[model samples]
Target: MFAYYLNKTLMHIFYKNAALTDYLKSINIQQTSIGFVPTMGALHQGHLSLMERSMLENEITVVSIFVNPTQFNNLEDLAKYPRTLDEDVKKIESLNPKIIIFAPNVEDIYDGKPSSESFDFDGLENQMEGKFRPGHFNGVGTVVQRLFEIVKPTNAYFGEKDFQQLQIIKKMVAKKNMGINVIGCQIFREPNKLAMSSRNELMSPNEKQEASLIYETLLNAKEKFETNSAHAVTDYVQKTFKKNTDFKLEYFQIADEVTLLPCLRKNKNKKYRAFIAVFINKIRLIDTISLN
Candidate 1:
């Protein structure tokens, strides 16, 4: 069975603004410490883990599953992105937390108008995901900002798999000076060590095996990090993946964790990490590892 039981009592889904607001008001949400976990549907274990953490830390947990359209630079990718609302609701309900599922429609979120607010991440946008996917972070910022306004949660949870996105959201919260704490949870990985992602559903079994090489490469880089220079480690990873015909390596950056800037040379004072994006069977996958 997809879920142990369809516990309708635990899962409350809202598509309109008024109804959600009324319910939250009736429940006295303003008086409680609310934890918000925002997602783009196609729920996975990584999402569940975030919910579990939120539940442990806050009195009430709210999860939003709106696939923000503005985040997708490629129209086809946005179109192909998975949307399993029935299964997603089932998975969240299985957790048995009294969670509010805010699956708002585009019209409801945008209010029949477009989100035109621009965010300056101050060069955070010039890095990996931003450098390639133009205007992606803007969409992320817009939707997340909107959600935070609507939910008014005390704490927000995000997975570390999207490390850059996590940082961007934190930046957004800070810029807006919203009274909300942004928490970055650990990245959940599969048995083979490949970082779990909603996009994994598109991968065939053989393709999934090929994708594991991305993490394997990161592990290899981490080992080399102990003895090699940052530049040398990057070159090695690039050359190694170039030989593999299964996937095409987009970028492998060894960068400072906070600044998100590529490291010229390793500094013992600062923490460094390796971020990678690869195209496997036409689906783009990203993974990161601590080089230190």
Candidate 2:
């Protein structure tokens, strides 16, 4: 039957990892460059963009979807998070990627034991998302470090939407001498400009529509800088969202991209970004925009 052949074809094309070491050995012997994009399933346009870039630049692309439990500070949020693996696989197959999907049993990857290995980033983790959701970055860094060890990727792709996390991961790679290049991909958004996120799946119809405001507000904030509008910076963004009762504004401030320090001045040549985090229907959303 066509179904049988389809199943066989899908296995060969998408889910190709038989063993971690075996896959690595094959790539090494062939001298193929490996690119990785790690995600927590519920694949969205944002994740695909990373994979597309990896496919274009490297001979092999590997994506892992683990819904890392270690990364979530709230058990309820973790349970509510989406997981559409069957559909996610179809999406990956459409890319026709020279890709391997690493969906391992937790025991295989983490030995089914509680992970005591935690990393402290010297105050980097304490800022932004860290201030609100403590222990998040350590969970992020822990799984990412494990992935780096398993994949040993020549290059890895992450999104700028998680700007703080990206900075910390880059620091980990550098300080630990991991010998992996971490590239930050631009945030992919919908036509209405909501930054694409797996958590967006949990949003109600109205919540998703209202979530567009997060990005729109950042755009307006960026324009403030572009037009050299020196009036109260954070005050402007906070006041704009104050009208939206459905959303709880987390933080809306412009900061230097590299130093993660708030930008108190408007200089045309100075690189700056507008970062915003708001809760729509109790689901937290984060986004950033460059002020050019």
Candidate 3:
């Protein structure tokens, strides 16, 4: 039947270590360059773009669709996080039937313990997102490190929308000497220039429309950053949000891209990015813009 072959084409999806392990063993690992794109499983254009890039650049591409519980600091968020495995699989199948999928459960990843292992990213974990969502980077580091161990991909792709987390992940890779190529991809945006996120699924039309200002404000801050101090730019972003009653500003900082420390004074030689978080109703959204 048509459904049988369709299902067979999707058989590359691995739910257990043995399935993925046996599949990988069939390939020539040393000779093949594997590209990995890991996601929490709401397949947006942003996620698909990463997978498309991986397929173009590598001999093989693997996409992991796991809703990482340890990564969520809030239990309610974990409960509300979207699980679109059926829809996600179809997207991956349409993208490339050959691309492998790793849809693991907590037991497969953490042996069911489900706790974050603390990591010292040289205080990189203490600032920005870590400052507000305590143990977030630790959950991130733990899950990512464990996934890396299990998947053993040659290169891993991450979006720059989570710019701070990307930097911390890079630091973790370097400190741990993982030897894998940690690649940072550009932030994928919506029609209104809002960075695409899984949390956007939880937003109402008005909330998403209002959330568009977050990126627009960040872009404005980036333009002002050329002639202004980081402190002034932060103030400008803060003032912009204060005028608008919709988005409650959480935190905003223009920081060194390498260190992620809020740069009060701009250093022309160093790379800096404007990072921001805001609460649009119950949904907390974060976005960043490069300030050269």
Candidate 4:
């Protein structure tokens, strides 16, 4: 009973928009570092981890849950993405956060003028998941820039599961002289090693069970990379993926964690990351693992 009451009280504390901005200004934020975690609604433990980290490390934290339609390359997928703001609000309020939760509707956020600023690179946004879903990264850049403008956080947290997205955002930040510190958090996975994602909510009971294959394949690739040569690792990954005829493989590549450029050989000199994307009945699922 007491817990329920506390939850309600905390929920009421979250101020929206101008009120939130006023509250932040009312408080002297000088030297009180701000941390931001931007996401589309459908809060899960993965998102909570980012929030918890931000709380631990910063004096103030803001979490934005705007399901930016522009980021969705597919209109159907955008329409289908889940929204549980009431539950999500309850979830974040429990943290007693000095956090501003931004939950804006589509029209409220964008003017429908297809963001004029689009990002381009030689290979960063052209391969792997980018190759599979064209123009997806443009949507990412657009919404991220919007969030940066709204929150103006001192540091932002991003998960490594979206390795390419993370890299692209960092590049965008640097290219534009945004000056905001972007921290890439290690991907949070389940006990079975499946990377946590909002889309996981879309999985059926049977699909969830079979979905473990994505993580298993990544784990297999990691093992092969450590002991076997690059050629052997590539061959094993291809063959293992072929066994899972039920799923359509997107792209699986090992790349540097920092630069995100493809890594061919296993070496201790630098950290490596393994990225994978697959489709289970047209629902795209992505996961990553550590190679080093």
TM-score of each: 0.95, 0.91, 0.96, 0.88
lDDT of 3 by residue, 1-292 (tens): 0121355574477888777877777884577988999899988999999998999889989889999888888999999999998899888888888888898899888897999998999988888899899889889999899888878888999999998888888899999999888888998998888899999989998788878899889889989988988878888988998998877999998888888887977677999988899998789999998887
**Candidate 4 per-residue C-alpha lDDT over 1-292 given as tens digits, one digit per residue, 9 for 90 to 100:** 0122333363323324555566556763578788899988698887888898998888888888888776677899988899898788778876654466776656545754655357875467876767777788888888899778767788999887887888889888988899999888878876666778888889886787788888888788888787777667767777877888878877777877776777776668988887878888877899878888
Model 3 C-alpha RMSD to native: 2.2
> Which residue pairs in candidate 1 collide?
none
lDDT by residue (79-145, candidate 2, tens digit) is 9999887787778877763467777656656777746367867667877788788788988998899
User: Which stretches of model 2 miss by more than 4 angstroms?
Assistant: 1-18, 227-231, 266-269
- Model 4: residue 10 alpha-carbon error in angstroms: 4.5
Query: lDDT of all the models against the reference?
Result: 0.87, 0.79, 0.87, 0.77
Deviation (Å) of 16 in candidate 4: 6.7
Candidate 1 structure quality by residue, lDDT tens digits, 234-277: 89988988899878888999989998999897789999889999
Ranking by TM-score: 3, 1, 2, 4
Comparison by TM-score, 1 against 2, better one: 1
Off by over 4 Å in 4: 1-7, 10-19, 112-116, 121-123, 264-270
Best by TM-score: 3
User: Considering TM-score, which of the candidate structures 2 and 3 is the better prediction for this target?
Assistant: 3
TM-score of candidate 3 on Cα atoms, chains taken together: 0.96
Off by over 4 Å in 1: 1-10, 29-31
